[model samples]
Target: MRHRLVTRGAVALCILVAVALIGYGLAQAMTTSHQQTVQGTSENSPHSGDGTKANPRRTRLEVGLDGCTKGWDDPGAGAQVFDIKNTSDRPMDVVLLGTGDKAADPHHDPRKAQIYAELEALGPGVTRSMTTSIEAGHFHFSCMPEDGPVVDGTDTNVPQPSAELASSLPSPVQHAAPATEQELIPYTQQYEEWVKGQLPDIASQADQLKDVIQRRGPNWREEAQSIWLTAHHRYMTLGGAYGAFGDLGDSIDGTAAGLPQGPNDPDFTGFHRIERGLWANESPDDLLPLAQGLSNDLSSLQDQDLAVGALEIGLRTHEVSEDIATQTLSGVDDFGSHSGVDSARAQTEATQKLVEILRPLLADRMPADHLTAIDQRLDAAQKRLDDASAAHPQTAPADLPVPERNAVRSQIGQLSEQLAEVAAVTDIRRAT
Candidate 1:
């Protein structure tokens, strides 16, 4: 009896061990499955690792001839994802706008609306995702087809959150409200007047350049170079009006970058072409016609009505700084004269003037602190350029010490970014 009891006891111990092993295998399998699931989710989610196990609510928005946001239903105020699909035959643009304090109307004018997010050039049958946080407001999507007019989606009214919930919710991104074309007209006119005023001085300098080239004296080359640089700098200060200048602009200051025969192309007849001939030791007589042509172009520019549009004014606020950073600093515009540093200084001055022209409008639309930051960045860039010029006068931009060159580039880059904000704030929006 005692032996039987001991054998049963040993069997019971074996059963317990077997059950323990089985439990361990099940736990391991579950852990592996859970890890695989998480990995798959991370691969598919755009906003993964946002410290949340559940994905943000997603709503599908269909863009068709009928409407821009046909499939959207109010998802209540919270973080959400939009699956924007273009159901039209052509490409389209979609903008989510917050019409502040206004009645929820699908036909509300977008010029007064604050843009929350936008998806541009969404092609037919293609779908894209936009993630954003929504707060209590009157919201709608404006869909613009490449071939048709803009169609607004049905308005979605998100109820205001409780004070406690509002405090915890992430603030939604809101771009500065757009300006109207009428509001921008006065600023454009002012800039056009300023551009016109500079033309006479530029024309006079061009004539001086021609005279210096004609003299062929020992110091003629030096005088011609000085006059050419002065004229070019003055023209560059009219950066805001370059678009309005159109082909005339290319004729005056365009480089030989894209020409078929480069410097020999017939179209390569501008300040750069003259620069190459002067620095290459070509005969003054050979360069006489180019100088004459430049003077004529300036005279013609003076006679024409300088009409700088509102859009160009907004774009130039940033484009001037961009040109300095990309072209001047990179030595792409240096044909032979290596006067990039001087050109950059002229462009910087132009940008400063543009900012001042938009200051009144910007102050009304953007935060004062943001405007101050933009000014500070511009000042920093100007200071860096001044220090470089004072320390190494007439040195080429690329030839400056690496640290100094980098400092200038960095400051200009920052200034460009800030100025881009200005462009966006001042841009005129259209409702059709």
Candidate 2:
């Protein structure tokens, strides 16, 4: 009996040893696998930035009343984003600054250039984010070499850029130089003609936007939204390229698609701020940063303002119209930051604010007959939006290729001219 028991005990001990060895081997394999997986993670991980987490990109950077961004509203608002392909042979740190003819300073109060985000040294082929918070303002983008700040003790009293220390900085973009003014001039002229064409159509586009909004059902909103977004993007881009909206979308796009399509933005309170500044009153605050981001050599931006004045022509149509209380616009400001949806939202919001300023001003100043005529136009605009809302977005995709968008661009151009008559602000009473 003792011998049998001893044999059994010996068998159990061997089995236990085998199981323990197998478990240990599996654990070791898993640990090694996990470490390797981590090691292979992308080089741009925030951790790769000196082992720190990446800061969430901001959409709004506010300094008192001043704001600036590449996007329509701000950075991440609706600026065209493309990856920086830095194949430049030079080894340098790239500094991003908002610039005009005037230089930028941290202490320099706005009404001049403003400094936003700075991305430091990025060796060739490495990528980094070009990011800043979104605010409804103007922004100019340019890159300076890392030494541009410190090379001659020029800005020495100013602190060195924090971007320099960022390990995750993206390589700065530097476009190849144009060898000839002849090559550049046609491109400039083409852009000029394209913009000049838009000033005539601002009113019609606004009317089209209203139709897209009201006549269509909830689903059709996206299609209508895209129409105005393209219009808004054009206006903002024109503003950047030229400086203000040259009275283009003044009539139809403003009050109709502006916020007449509200209840969409969730935050309903901000609407009051827009209404008070623009429509209800004419304090210089109506335009805020829009009014401020100006430089002494301001012809380009001023032309844009003229375009914007053209964009405001809709205020004439909506002025005698107290119908907005009855109209419903979705997500009036609900478009969240950085989402593609936000661009549409910002454009719509900007239009509403513009009208808010123009309507009250137009009503107070324009003749009764003119006000009545504008009201009739508003009635037509209301019907158009009603029809558009009833149509399906899928019926006509808003993202029709660039050619279609450009083709449609003509109508918006005609609309701008319609608004220009209203722009004769001989009616604008001095702000008491």
Best candidate (score: lDDT)? 1
Runs of candidate 2 exceeding 4 Å displacement: 1-189, 201-243, 246-330, 333-391, 394-432
What's the lDDT for residue 392 in model 1?
84
Off by over 4 Å in 1: 1-55, 70-74, 104-110, 216-218, 265-267, 426-428
What does candidate 2's lDDT look like per residue over 379-430, in tens digits? 4443433334344222231433445333333322222223333433211211
TM-scores of all models? 0.80, 0.20
Q: What's model 1's lDDT at 135? A: 72
Write down the lDDT that model 2 would get: 0.30
Report clash pairs, candidate 1. Answer: none
Cα RMSD (Å) per model?
19.4, 27.5
